[model samples]
Target chain A: MEKVVLGNHAVSYGVLVSRVQTISAYPITPQTLIVERLSEMVADGELDAIFTKVESEHSALASAIGSSSVGARAFTATSSQGLALMHEMIHWASGARLPIVLANVNRAMAPGWNIWTDQNDSLSCRDTGWMQIYCQNNQEVLDSIIMGYKVSEQVLLPTMVCLDAFVLSHTAENVDIPEVKLVDKYLPPYKLEIKMDIDDPHSFGALSSPENYMEFRYKMQEAMDKAEDIIIKEGKEFEKIFGRKYGMVEEYRTEGAEIILVATATIASTAKASIDSLRAKGINIGLLRLRVFRPFPVKDVVRVLLNKKKAIVIDRNISYGKSGIFFDEIKGAFYNIEGDKPKIFGYIAGLGGRDVTPEAISDMVDDAMRKDKPEKDIIWSGVKL
Target chain B: MIEILIHGRGGQGGVKASLSLASAAAKAGKHVQSFPEFGVERRGAPVKAFNRISDEPIVIRSKIYNPDHVVVLDPTLIQSINITEGLKKGGWIIINTDKNPGDFKEFCKNYKVATINAKEIALRNRLGSRAAPIVNTAILGAVIKVLKVSDKESLAIAIKEFVPVKREENVKAAYEAYDEVVFEGEV
Candidate 1:
């Protein structure tokens, strides 16, 4: 059924339809509504699940890890500081190979104190061994969460469905809530092959000797590598079940375009408008919306961007000392390519929830088109000098 | 595409009003999107929410900088906010006040203006306590009247879908405001 619902509520509905057996979450701005709605569903007997109210984000993820260890499908959500608090357990969940799915509303981290939209919080956890998928809208948030479980369980790696705080999290849109049976068909009841059973009684996450530890890390890396294929396969299967299909990277009118603008999260959605307006004016520009951040779709990124003369990467978060996180990653993706790489320019905008308008996006594209080579590695767009 | 900017104080149901409006438009088979601009969110703090209704899907995820229509649930917000700042020319400003549309002639000089005694209508329908009259639902009715985006019945259905409590009173307030809205001539 189609209903106009908040982006956060869409996440809850996705979790509900996925039939997540255990929900452990701590309330935080932007992400709070997701767990609140889930709690209401559980309280009203609408969804059959155990909603665990944990004291902190650490416990929230820890409880989810505990539930997943017992072979139960578990879910949790948080934002900003709460996500930072869960940093330790984040590794624990993935290291133990638990297929826990988490919804992280992307909020800017603070000593300055902010609760608005930014990608820093989620991007900071990039190396934590979790597969990350950033959503452009509420529909993607809902669809990706359902697909997240399918991908995670298949590869035994946890997944984080990240959406911008207040941007997509608070936005309401027409979302087609799939029938329970349809979701059940897409994501069957999760059955773990290796689970903590009292009868079997095998030690999990025990102390590994130096030689054994290297093998475990290698296995986890193998799983991460395997996840890329699973993500694509599940994406195709998702399209067959529901008419909506998603990919690791979405190319919008990139063919024969001189310049392509790359963005993720809601910023990518805005980039589409700039693409449309620029295209209407007969400017040869396109957009590449990166949907999946890790097991970063290197081949797909290379395929779409290699031939393009110039690519402008708009990043909402910064890596401080170096350059835009996405800019660095995309450049690294092209590092090993033999020859003729697109001249990629990175522009950091929308940090601390600053709005990235179509005008700013157009300016970035024009700037990239004008430059023979990046004068600087990263240009902070729209910031007062 | 019809872009709407809803201006109100926190606790005035500005976000809810936008959601109900979007839901009503969606019920009428139009693609709609609504979202609140996150701020302090404390009661009485100035808050704004946006709604977009269109024949095609809304791909733009940015805030509504230029609106086709503006709904001011709190008339007092006019003193503090340029509620019609980026409002397109010939855009409509629906204000919730007892004053005649003529009173806003100079302030709303370049756009079409509509007015309604939404507070009185809300009180008459017992939408909120007499002291704090919630005017968003009633203002939504004025929006429907000005834009003709949806009918009174569809809006009522949306209200029922959105507001689980005080359904009858809110629907009554909407209908009363719809019937009683006064439109100033377009400038």
Candidate 2:
């Protein structure tokens, strides 16, 4: 059914349709509405699940980890400070190879106490062995959560569905919620081959010697590598049922384009508008919306961007001494590519909920198109300094 | 595309009003998007919410700078906020004030101004407590009346969908404001 709902509520409905067995979450700004709606659903008997109200984010993910280890589909959500609190549990959940799905509303990290949108919260956890998928709108939030569960269960790796804090989380848009039977067919009951079983006792995350520890890390990497294909497969299956297709990366108007703008989350929507306006003026420009950040779609990124003359990456999070986190990733991805490649420009913008307007994006495009090579690797767009 | 900026206090349902307006536009077969500019969320803090209604899908997710219309849910907010900061030329400002349009002649110099005694309407309909009247729905009604984008019936359906309690009161308040809203030229 089509309903005008907030992006956070869409996450709740996604968890509902996925038939999550256990929900463990602590309230945080932006992300609070998601779990609040879930608790209401559980209390109203609309969703038959165990809603565990934990004291902190650490306990929240810990509870989800416990539930998933017991072979139940578990879900949780958190934002910037809350996610930072759950940092250790995040690695533990992934290291244990639990198929847990989490919705992280991306908020800016702060000493001055900001609760607005940024990518630092989720992107900072890149070293953790979890797959991350960013969403652009309310519909994508719902669809990606459903797909995150399917992909996570298949690959046995935790998944984080990230959306911009207020840009997507608090925004309301028309979303077509899938029927129960259809979603059931797409994401059936999760059955695990390895779980905490009383009948067959075995230690899951016991102490591993250095000789065996390397192999375990390798195996986790292997599973993350395997998730890319599973994510694509699940996305295709979801599209067949719901008529909305998703992928690790979405290429928009890239054909015969001279300049390409790379962005993720809600920023991609603004980039699309910039592309539309730029294209109208007879400029050869395109947009590459990076949906999935982990198990980074290296081959797809190379395939789409290898031929472009110039590419600019717009990142909402900074890596401090380094450039934007995504810009660093994209640059590192292209380092080993043989032959000529696009002159990649990295831009940092929209931090702490600063609006990345279409005009700013268009100016970035113009600057990128003019320069044959960037004087500096990273340019902080729209900042006064 | 028609962009609208709604100004209200934190607890006055500005965000809810924008959502209802977006929902009404969507129900009328137009694409719409609505979001609130969230700060340190607290009751009675100055808040702003935005809505975009268009025939085509809205691809720009930036904060509305040059809005085609502005809806002031609380008349007192006009004293503090530059409510007409980025209002487009020939745009309209629908305010929930008992004051006459001529009273805001300097403020309404660049835009069309419309007013409605929404607090009186909310009191008559008993939408909220007698001390704090819920004028969001009534202001929403004035917005629709000034813009003529969506009908009263469509907005009524949206109010029913969003307002959990006092649906009848909100719907009645909306229609009452729609009927009694005084435009600058009309007065």
Candidate 3:
């Protein structure tokens, strides 16, 4: 059904249609609505599932991990401090190969206590071996959840569908939720090849020693590498069933553009609006929205953006002393390839829920268009003391 | 862009109200952006949110220092906080208060104002007037009438999206407020 929905509600609807068997969550800002809606769905008999009211965000993931380990599709959500609290379990979920799907609403880390939109909360989890996909709107939030389940189950890995805290989270937009029958056809109930059995009991989460730790790590990397193909396949199949198609990345108005902005989530929407406004004024610019961040889409990056003379990465989350993480990854992707890697400049904006105004994006482009940027690595946009 | 500031407490459907307004305005062929700013992420604290609606894409990204219109969801917040700090001249102020418009005229100087007994409407409709949170829908109706930007039909569509079962009550509350509340100038 087509309706105006918030980002959090979209995730709830996505999980509901995907028929997630288990939902575990602890209340947290920007993410509380997701579980709240899910709980309502359960109470109203709209969905038949186990809704576990956990104590902390750690327990939320732990509960989902337990369900997934028992061979059931499980789900959870959190943001900022809650996500940071679940940091230890993040590695556990992925390391155990549990195929749990989580909706991570991005928020700023606290020293000053802020509840706004930014990617820092999710970006900090990029190394946790979870396939991270950022969304641009409520519809994407819903679609990505369905896609996350398919991608995760195929590779036996966890996935995080990230949407900016308030930009997409609280913002309302028209979202076309897939029908129950259609989603059921596209995503059948998950069937695991491995499960815990009393007759043949096996210990999970066992400590790894130096002799075997490297091999375990390599196997995990290999599984993530295989996920790219599985994701592409599932996406194509899903597109065939539904009318919408999702690629590793979505390029918007990028052809024959002189300058480009690499964005994710709501920034991609804003950049598109800016692209339209700028195009009317005769400026040739474009946008490339990075949908699948982890298991980084190297080929798509090269094919879509490497040829551009100048490209700017608008990072809503920064790596502090280091440059923007995606910029670093993109640089590494192009390191071995011949020819000039697009002069990728990184700009950090919308930190601590600060607004990433169209003017701010324009300023970032104006600075990146220059030959010499004062800061070679990460640039700050619209920061005030 | 028509910027509106909504003043309320944490649990008073303030976020819901902003979204309803945005969606309603969007349905009227406008681009909208709604956002909330707050300190305490709890149930009862002075909270404020903004919605920017325009025919074109919204580009302004600052807190609405000067709102073209204001919706006071909670009457107490007016005394606790300065709700009129950034109200633009000639702007409209919609207050969900039991007091008469004449009683608030002194406070709402330099701007057009309307006052409604939203709690009464909520009670009459058996919606339970515990702080009268649903008054936002009622205010939206009056806003549509006063602003002339959105029609009652569009406001009805927006309200239905949020509060479906209580559609008649909400629409009635909105119409009652529209009839009783006095805008500064006749429209």
Candidate 4:
């Protein structure tokens, strides 16, 4: 059934359909509704999951880790500062190789005490060894949770699904809820063969000496490498069952285009409007949305930009002294290439919840047209200085 | 696409107003998106919410700048806010006021002005207290009447589904506003 719901509620519905066994969260702005709905479902006897009302975001994730280690499909959610507080557990959850699913509402980290949507919060956890999927719409937010679990379980890695705070978390949109039977058929119950058992107590994640630690790290890296193909395989099977096609990246009118606009999250959705307008103005511009952020789609991204003349990469988050977070990643993907490559310009916009309207995007395209090469590594769009 | 901007104060269901309108539009077989300008919310502070409705899919996920219509749930908001910042000409400015629609024409010229005593209707239906009336659902009724975006049945269903309290009374209030919606003059 389809219903109009806030994007946060969409995440809750996704968890419900996934038949998650353990739910843990601490209330945070833009992320409260997600857990609130899940709590209601648990309390009202709808979803038979244990709702762990923890004291801190750290405890929230730690508790999820505990449940997942016991072979329960666990879930947790947080935003900005809450996610920051869980940084330690972030590494612990992945290093332990538990298939826990987390929904992160991407809010700008605060020194100014702001609570708005931005990508910096999740981007900061880039090397967490967790699979991350950034969604452009509420439907994607819901679908990614189910898909994230299916792939993560097979690869034995944690998955983090991200959506822009308020832009998605609070916005109301229509989302079709997939059938319970179909989700069940696609994702069966979690049964870990190696779990902490009460009858047979075995220590896990104990002191790792130099002799064994390297092998553990190598095995984790191997799993991440295997995850790339698993994501595509599950995505195709998802489309066959759910009738919605998803991939590492989605292309819009990019065939034979000279210029391509690379955007992520909801900003990519807004860029489509600007692409339509730019197309009308006779500009050969198209859009390429980077959907799966981790196990970062280097092969797909490099292939997409090979023939394009120039690429405009827009990021809503920045690395303090370096370029935009996504700009750095996309550029690094082409570092080893020797042949001609698209001169990718990085434009940082919409940080701290500033509106990146279609007109503002059009202005960026115009600015890109004027420059053969960007004067700087990073250009701030609509900033005072 | 038809974009509508809503003006109200925090704690007045301003955000829910936009949601219900989009819900009604979605019920009417149109694609819709609704979102509020996320702010440090406090009661009595000015708040804005937006909705985009279209027969085709709505792709642009950004703030609505040039809305085709405006819905004002509180007349007092006009004193502190520019209620028509980016509203288009020849569009409807639906206001919830007891005053005549002609009284707003000076400030709302070159547009179709509409007035509905949503506060009175809401109070009569006991939707909220006399001091602070729940006029969001009532104003949506007048909006649908002026914009022809949805019918009374769709508005009723949307209100019944969205409003957390006083569902029957809110539905009744919306139907009354749809029936008693006033127009200042011909556009």
Candidate 5:
């Protein structure tokens, strides 16, 4: 049934439909509503799961890791500071090869103290080996969780289903929740072959010496590398059941276009809106949204941008002194191209939830179309200073 | 697509109103989006929320700038802020006031002014205290009446399922405001 729900609550419902066995999380703004609804669902006897109330995000993930180690479907939700607090455990969750699914509401990191939306929080942990899928709306937010769990369990790596803090977490929209039975049929229960069992006792994360540490790291990378195909396969299966196409990147009107706008999360949605008007005005503009961040869709990115004349990337987060993180990735992805490739331009906007409007997106398209090449590495849009 | 910007003080259930309105529209099978612009974070402090209704899925995940209509949950906000800053001309400027809709005609010249004594209605239903009346439900009722985007049945069900307490009161208040709302000019 379809219902209007907050984006945070959508995550809870996704966890419910996925039939999660364990939920451990600490409360944080934007992310609080997710766990709040889950706890309510558990308390009300709707979802029969062990709701672990931990003191901090660190303990939260640690508890989830514990459950996953024992072959239970563990889940957690958190925001910026909470995610930052879980930084150490973030690496452990992936390195341990625990198929834990985490819902991270991407919130702006604070110095002046903020609780708004930004990509910096999730982008900061890009190297943690946790597969990340940035959502464009609440429906995607809900769908990604179910997909995350399936892909994570198959790949034996953790997944982070990310949505922008308030843009999605606080926003309410109609989301069609697949019946629990349908999701059950789509994603069968997982059983860890090599698990921590009392009868057949084993140690986890004991130590990795120089002889085998490199192999362990290489295997983790291999799992992440193989995840792209598994994600696509599972996403297709999810579409067969749920009637919504899921993929690493969604292309909107990119056929035979002179310039294409590239972004992720909610910014991509607004960019698509701008593309509509630009097309109406006889401008050949398009959009490409990078849905899956980790297991980076390098092949799909190359496939989509191979023919476009110019591609403009809009990032809502920065890498401090370096360029935008996604921009850097796209540049590196196109580095090996021998012949002509789209003149890629990196534009940063909407950091700290400043709002990347359709107008701003159209302006970027117009700016990119006008220039022979990007004047600077990072063209800051909407920055007052 | 229709965008409505709601202006209210904190603790006034402005965000809930937007959500309920969105729910009502969604119940009627229309696509909707609702969210709040959280600032200052204190009761009686000015706050903003938004709603977008469309026939197609809403892909513009940007803050509403040029709202097609405006809903003012607290009438006092009129003096302090530009409540109608980006409101489209000839749209409804729904305000919670005891005075008749004609009183706001001069103030909301281009837009049609919709007035409802939602505070009185909410107080009569005992939805909130006299000092802090919950005008969101009643305001949503007035919004439904002025916009014709949702029906009473949908609004009733939405309010019944949304409110934490006094569910019946909220439903009654919404229906009362639906019948009692006074607006200038034809909708």
Candidate 6:
């Protein structure tokens, strides 16, 4: 049925529809509502799942890993600091190839203890081998969760769908939640091809020597490589059942445009508006919204921007002393391509919970279009003393 | 396009005000985006939230710098914060205080100002004391009446969606504040 709901509640609903067997979490601002709703669902017997109220974010993920190891479809959630605390467990979850799904309400990490939305928290874990999908609105936040689970289970990799903390989390929007019957029809119960068997009593997380470690690592790479196809297949199946199909990347008005802008999260919504506004003004601008971050859709991005003369990337999170996080990834993808690479301009904006208005984005696009020389560098937008 | 910034304490429904404004605008078939900038890192701290409403979807993710309208839930916050910085020319200001618009104009110039005792109206409407500071529902009435952009049905749907259970009280508070808030005259 269709109802108006907040973004965080949509994630909780996604968990419910996905039939998650084990759930765990610790309360954090912006993200607290998600766990609260899940807890209420568990208590009211609406969602039949083993709910684990853990003490720390570490334990929340560790508990999920434990549950998944025993062959149960598990779920958990957290934000900036909570996600930071679960860093070690993230590696553990991914390395073990468990198809667990986590919803991270993106928030600014603090020395000042701010709880506003930003992307740095999740971007810091880019190398953790977890398939991450950043959402643009309430519907994407909900749909991505279900899709993340379906994709993760196929590849045996943990997945995280990132939503801007307060932007999507606390804000309410009209969302159409499919019936449980539809969800069930789309997502069958978790069936494992390989799992720890208590009766067989096999060793798990054993020490690896150099001779065998490479083979295991190669196998994990194979799983990640296989994820691309599985994600597309399941996304198609999802469309058939739920009437919504999401690709690793979505192009908005990029055809015949000279400039392309890439972004994730609610920022994509803003970019879309800017694109539409500029289009009406006779500006040749388009947008590419990245749905999947990990197993980064390198080829798709590279192919999409090949003919575009200029590409502007707005990064909400900074990677400390280095360039914008996604800029580096996108550039790396174009390094070996045989065509003229689009001149890439990176803007670091909206960090530490700063607002990103349409005017600001318009200015950024105009600046990128004005570049006299094509070079690789990053610029900070809306930065003040 | 109209940008609205709301200043209030964490418990005063400052966030609720922005969401309600967004709901009202969305119901008018306007593209709208609303978000709270304040973190619940501490209670009773001066908190702010924002709303952007236009006929088209918004793309700028920046916080509202100069708002077309500013709503202050508490009069005391005026001293604690600028409360007027970045206010657009001829912008509208809505202040919920016992002090009428004349007293508020002493601190505000270069714009249109509206003042009303929303807390008193809320209390009289049986919205209770806790929600007294959150005159957003009442303030929304004044905003819609002054802006003349939102349909009455849109305001009704917004109130219903935001204050569903206390429909009567919310509607009463809205009407009371709408009556008292002076757009170009004495309260």
Model 5 chain A worst lDDT window (10 residues): A334-343
- lDDT (C-alpha, whole model) for all candidates: 0.90, 0.90, 0.82, 0.91, 0.91, 0.83
Better of 1 and 3 by DockQ: 1
lDDT for A362 (candidate 3): 80
What's the TM-score of chain B for every model shown? Answer: 0.95, 0.95, 0.88, 0.95, 0.96, 0.89
Q: By descending TM-score, how would the candidates be arranged?
A: 5, 4, 1, 2, 6, 3
Say which docking band candidate 6 falls in.
Answer: acceptable
- Candidate ordering by lDDT (highest first): 4, 5, 1, 2, 6, 3
**Candidate 1 lDDT, A257-298, residue by residue in tens:** 988899998999988989999999999988998999999989
**Candidate 4: which docking quality band?**
medium
Report the lDDT tens digits of candidate 3 across residue range A1-385.
Answer: 6666778999999999999999997999888999999999999989889999999999999999999998889999999999999999999999998899999988888978888877788888889999999888777789989989988988889999998877778766667788989998989889987787677788877888999989988988999899999888988998898888887898889988977789877787778867777778887899988889988999888887777787788888778788878887777788889875578888888788777767678878878877654357878787776
TM-score of 5: 0.98
lDDT of 2 at B64: 92
Minimum summed lDDT over a 10-residue window in model 6 chain A is located at A369-378
- Of the pair 1 and 5, which is ahead by DockQ? 1
Displacement of the residue A201 alpha carbon in candidate 6, Å:
4.1
- Give lDDT tens digits, candidate 6, residues A169-275: 97665567888888888788898766788777888899999989889778778888888888888889988988887888989999888889998887888788789
What lDDT tens digits, residue by residue, belong to model 2 across residues A145-216?
Answer: 899999999888999999898888888988888887899989989898888999988898888999799998
Docking class of 3: acceptable
Instruction: Rate residue B110 of model 5 by lDDT.
Output: 82
The positional error of residue A187 in candidate 5, measured at the CA in angstroms, is 1.2
Per-candidate TM vs. native? Answer: 0.97, 0.96, 0.85, 0.98, 0.98, 0.86
How many angstroms is residue B66 displaced in model 4 relative to the true structure, after the best TM-score fit?
Answer: 1.8
Task: Report the lDDT tens digits of candidate 2 across residue range B87-158.
Answer: 998788888888977789876768888888999999998878777998888888888888877889999999
Estimate the TM-score for candidate 6.
Answer: 0.86
**Model 5 stretches with alpha carbons more than 4 Å out:** none
